[model samples]
Target: MSKISTDPTRRALNGPTMGTRWTALFHVDPAIDTDPVRAALQAAVDEVDAQMSTWKPDSDLMRLNAAPVGVWQTVPMPLLEVLVLGRDIGLASGGAFDMELGDAVAAWGFGSDTADPVQIRAAMGRHRNTAALEIDVAGARVRKTADVALDLNGIAKGYGVDRLADTLVALDLPAGLVGIDGEMRAMGLRPDAAPWSVAVEAPDPARRSPHSVLALHNAAVATSGDYRHWIDVQGCRLSHTMDPARRAPLVAPPASVTVIARTCAEADAWATALMVLGAEAGATLARQIGLDALFLLRDPTMGFRSKAVGRLFCDQCPEAAAQHAQ
Candidate 1:
């Protein structure tokens, strides 16, 4: 085991938003300069951006999407790992979480370009049910019976956060928190022997306050909400989290789902899955699978109301019971 040190002050790096503002922090030996660590952290972000970003046409994900069916296209190991994990989670969630929604996302104007009804409709028409995708893990190849474009926006950032954390740990500095946008992962504890703290954003766009704060150690947290990304068409508001079955933006009112798990990837996917499940069904499913989750619903008179499911740690304490009426 590497010697855990407490002599150095923590170092942090911040940069212009790639899509959004991303921040990384690590506690390293005091004698080490910060520039090299900053460079390494930025390199990790660049790798994720090049391989997983949907905004980039030349990204590895796009290559896989453009490949001919039945032909195995070699892909970067990082992307391959993400796809494999994503497919498994999609199956486990009963299609609630899917990567084959590239068309839906692009049509909704959440992708690189503005929304095009024609492209949206075309993408919808080409939507190949995720169930039809055949992935050979041992072979490191994937085959789709029909044309289904892939998107990793839902879980990629969380995976990136995990990757950043892993990179920090590999450098022998395993104690710190890494967050991209709002998704985050914390390892070990702060120098004070307490867990790192994270604030859960309020679901309401009108409200800028944080509703709650969680203390986490060696775990990850991810939140999915429609407040940040949505489109208003005529009199209706359509969110980016589309219903894969309907091939359209989620018709239901917006809600924020937050998930906590052993890894950021699982938490991210599960958060999206719970959003698709909506308040009632999502809470139930979260309980069934023993997930730490919080669902906030838009109440007509109450503004935003919330519920907690499974095990959750807030203020460094665990809340028992799968569901809590808040």
Candidate 2:
């Protein structure tokens, strides 16, 4: 006679979306079939990509972009929700995280086409007037009061991650961790009753490695950094994140900024906002808003130095400070 183990089987699944991959991790009974769950996950992300992708000319976002200013455009509820949230974050971040930078993004080669000097000059010369977006929630429509090219690249993936988590819950599968690219959301604890462990990637383009780790349960985390995507111009390496005021890439920004929030969408947008604000101003805003954020700065001598705000990160600053100092 032999004793049998009663532990649930761990499962990991991933699929392509947004030129990257979306992933789900969980534990369930070994006998349970996962095909339905997998399909649901894929469908959830597909819906997001269809509605929000700037690369797709037929996407709802592009349709709105093409629409003449001041004319209302009908949008799906999901897209509407994202648009509303993007506007809110833009206001909250004091225009640091702008959605109306699509022109600048496309001109810089971060969008559908390669960089164009002619378009870049035009983008840079434009005055900074944040768009006035109007949302009719009941009608599920949105309109812009001015000429603005909207982009949701900063927040869409986070919302996609949220959808994955929601999909898992709808399927009656709790206890899971879901992510699109590096933006992640954690549901209930693992089968063994532990929070999901997520790594904060180091801002090193040469290699992939962890700078720190977070234990998340019912929370989400996201990071914005300079290393992952960039372009070279006149011997200068510029990050993909644009400065809304200048309508150009940030000249000086943190190596990376990581944010933890109740929703992945909030986390993702704030990370980008903080990157624009830099460590000093960002730390102030994070503290004022009760946000948990970690700023990694490039230090010539120490390699990387960190500045943390909010209780979650400050509580662990001693360790992070020591590690980053070296």
TM-score (all chains, Cα) for each model: 0.90, 0.96
The Cα local distance difference test for each model comes to: 0.79, 0.90
Cα lDDT tens digits, model 1, 1-326, are 33555475778886543587567776666678877777777788789889988788898888878887777776777888888889888988889898889878988798877989898787667645756567677777776666778889888988888888887888788888898889999899888787888888887666667777888888888999988788889988778898888777887744788899888988999999989988788878887888888887788898777777764722123222222211
Best candidate (score: TM-score) = 2
Q: Which clashing pairs does model 1 show?
A: 310-322
RMSD of each: 4.3, 3.0
For candidate 1, the TM-score is 0.90
Q: List, residue by residue over 30-122, the lDDT tens digit for candidate 2.
A: 778999999999999999999999999999999999999889899999999998888899999999999999999999999989999999999
